[model samples]
Target: MLVKDIMQDIGETKKKDTRFTNRLIPFHDVCSVSSGDIDNAIKSAGKEYLKDGSQAAGQKFMGVVKIRNNNTVNKESIINSIGDIFTKNHTVDLNDPDFTIIVEVFRNVCIVSVLTDYIKLRKFNIFGLFSGGFAEPKKSIHKDP
Candidate 1:
């Protein structure tokens, strides 16, 4: 619901003669979760993304999945499973895509999105993702005024 609200807000603010039929989306998770639920959640989210009419004409899209606080679901396995759901014509264009999907799997839920822009991705820091968990926070150098 929040994603839809945010999309509507962005569409209204952009003031562009554009349709949301094909635009990249970013996802945020806020649902209840349980063991072995990632697969279903992902499938459901993917369907929602498609139903939103966000997939571009060519089905050329990019994606990034984040898993936090999950211990059982393997990212590779999820990717493989999800990949199969797409049409055979689907292709991943990492460098430049008609749209991008961001999948965030948190402790209690999973979220999949088709982002409208890549701006939000600039803040994603790979250095923060560690083997066990997010990398420890580094000390800030700037002092509060």
Candidate 2:
């Protein structure tokens, strides 16, 4: 995978050679849908990733990160809607979640996936990876819905 190779190169060389690429997000599903259908799209795409009963039994923390390229979509509403899809046993932990739900909206298209170690990966920003700056855990004011 190109992403894996780039990440491996970054780790091995510690050199900042990337340009033009901002973030590398691997998605499980993608669909062309209106803002109104975002919730259903995410639900369908993320069902398998969120349905792990064994992991939920341990009360894993989950966080949602929504990136909207257009002004038509409400970011908070999307995040909350995705949060509701997770099992009740999962708690909200924005700073250091066990899993992160990514909702990337570009006009009428939406890409959805669940990822682990999102924070540690510098939110998948290639530039951030070479900066040697780590994301310090922050206190979250976000409550579980």
Best by lDDT: 2
lDDT, candidates in the order shown: 0.49, 0.67
Can you give the lDDT of residue 137 in candidate 2?
A: 53
Clashing pairs in 2: none
- Candidate 2's C-alpha runs over 4 A off are 1-5, 16-19, 35-37, 65-71, 133-145
Give the TM-score of each candidate. Answer: 0.50, 0.73
Model 2 C-alpha RMSD to native: 4.0
Error of 1 at 99 (Å): 1.6
What is candidate 1's CA lDDT for residue 119? 29
Encode model 2's per-residue lDDT on 1-145: one tens digit a residue: 4664676577557776767787787886787656557767777765655566654443445655565567767777876776677755466676767677788877777887777666766777877777764455566566543
lDDT minimum window of 10 residues, candidate 1: 125-134
Model 1, position 94: C-alpha lDDT score:
56
How many pairs collide in each candidate, listed in order? 6, 0
User: On residues 20-139, what C-alpha lDDT tens digit does candidate 1 reach at each position?
Assistant: 333433454334544346555555655544543554433555666678998856677656655665544356655544455666777757776555434232313221111122222233
TM-score of 2: 0.73
